[model samples]
Every structure is written in structure tokens, then in C-alpha cells.
Target: MMRARTRKLIGTVALIIFLGVYAWVAAVIGAGRISLAPAWAQFAYFLAAGLLWVLPAGLLIRWMQRAD
Candidate 1:
């Protein structure tokens, strides 16, 4: 079992990596596929993608807080 501090550090690192990849993918998809959508649809997709990173982050945070 990891110490709380260690868990937090690992979680933070994981979160950073996850966010970087997530943003890159989102940007690529937004630039490629999303660019083909109508303006309103593109707006909606961008909005959804913007908020989508939070769910996995929340899960990671929850795990980081778990009792050892």
C-alpha cells in the first residue's frame, strides 16, 4: 500500500499525462473530424470534449484518496 503522499504524487503525475494525451487527441479530432461539422455541431462537440476530461480525473482523484 502506498503512503498518502506517494499516492498523491503518482496520481498527480498520472493526471498530467492523461490530460496531455487527452488534449492532444481532442485537438486532433477537433481539427480534423470536427472541422467538417456545421458550426453549431462543432460548438457542441467542442463543449462536450472540453468537459470530458474531468470524469477520468475525478476517478483518479478518488483512487488517490483511498485509505491504504
Candidate 2:
């Protein structure tokens, strides 16, 4: 069961990283010189999506370490 859970977690983290990269690209292209959105919006978008993967990865890593 632990092995299965770890595999699923890896898949989930990979998906999140993919989505984060896509979102970063979209944000950069959508914001133009005359755009109202702050330049930081791109960074924020990337960060928020990246954290989705990071938080769970951290938790799972911690759990696995403890399990050892």
C-alpha cells in the first residue's frame, strides 16, 4: 500500500509542476506593456501552482522519513 501511495504522489507532483509551467507561460504572454496586471502576477501565478506540488511533496517526504 505504501508503494502504491508513493507512486500516486509522484504522478500528482509531476502534474502540478506541468500545470505551473503552463500557467507561468500564459501569465507572461497575457500581460502586455499596457496591461493593468502587475508584472509580479506572473511570478505569483507560478509560485501558487508550484506550491501545490511542493506542499504535498514535503508532507509525503516527511511521512516516508518518519516511516523509516
Candidate 3:
């Protein structure tokens, strides 16, 4: 029980940090490159960037919920 709780706490903190960093990086790249692209390309890039974090986050959430 303690292990699971610990995992959840760590994972939550890690997820928050990961999301913050990821959003910063994505914004940087988008401003640097995607901003200059065509409208459709910029839209595509933003769409992909927006959803890309879900995969890793989902995995982390699964790991956090797993039994010890």
C-alpha cells in the first residue's frame, strides 16, 4: 500500500514536471518553426504536438496504478 501510494505521488509530480517542460519545448519549437509554416502545416503541427503527450502520460498513469 505504501509503495503504491509512493508510486502515485512520484508519478504525479513527474507528470506535472514532464507536462510543464513539454509545453515549454513545444511552444519554443512551434514559435521557431511552425509559426513560419503555411496555415495548414501549422495547424497540423499544433494538433500533433497537443496530443503527443498523452501516450507517454497514459503509460505513466498505468505504471502508477499498477500493483506492487
TM-score of each: 0.90, 0.38, 0.93
lDDT of candidate 2 over 1-68, digit per residue (tens) = 46756756775676578667866765675565325556697667556755665666666556655442
Window of ten residues with lowest summed lDDT in model 3: 1-10
Q: Which wins on TM-score, candidate 1 or candidate 2? A: 1
Per-prediction backbone clash count: 0, 0, 0
- Please list the residue runs of candidate 2 whose C-alpha ends up more than 4 Å from where it truly belongs after superposition: 1-3, 33-68
- Per-residue lDDT tens digits for candidate 3, residues 1-68, read 55999999999999999999999999999999788899999999999999999999999999999998
Q: Which ranking of candidates, highest TM-score first? A: 3, 1, 2
Candidate 2 yields a Cα-based lDDT of 0.62
lDDT of 1 at 42: 99
Q: Which candidate is the best by TM-score?
A: 3
Kindly indicate the candidate among 2 and 3 with the higher lDDT: 3
lDDT of 1 by residue, 1-68 (tens): 68989999999999999999999999999999889999999999999999999999999999999988
- Candidate 1's error at 12, in angstroms? 0.7
lDDT of 1: 0.96
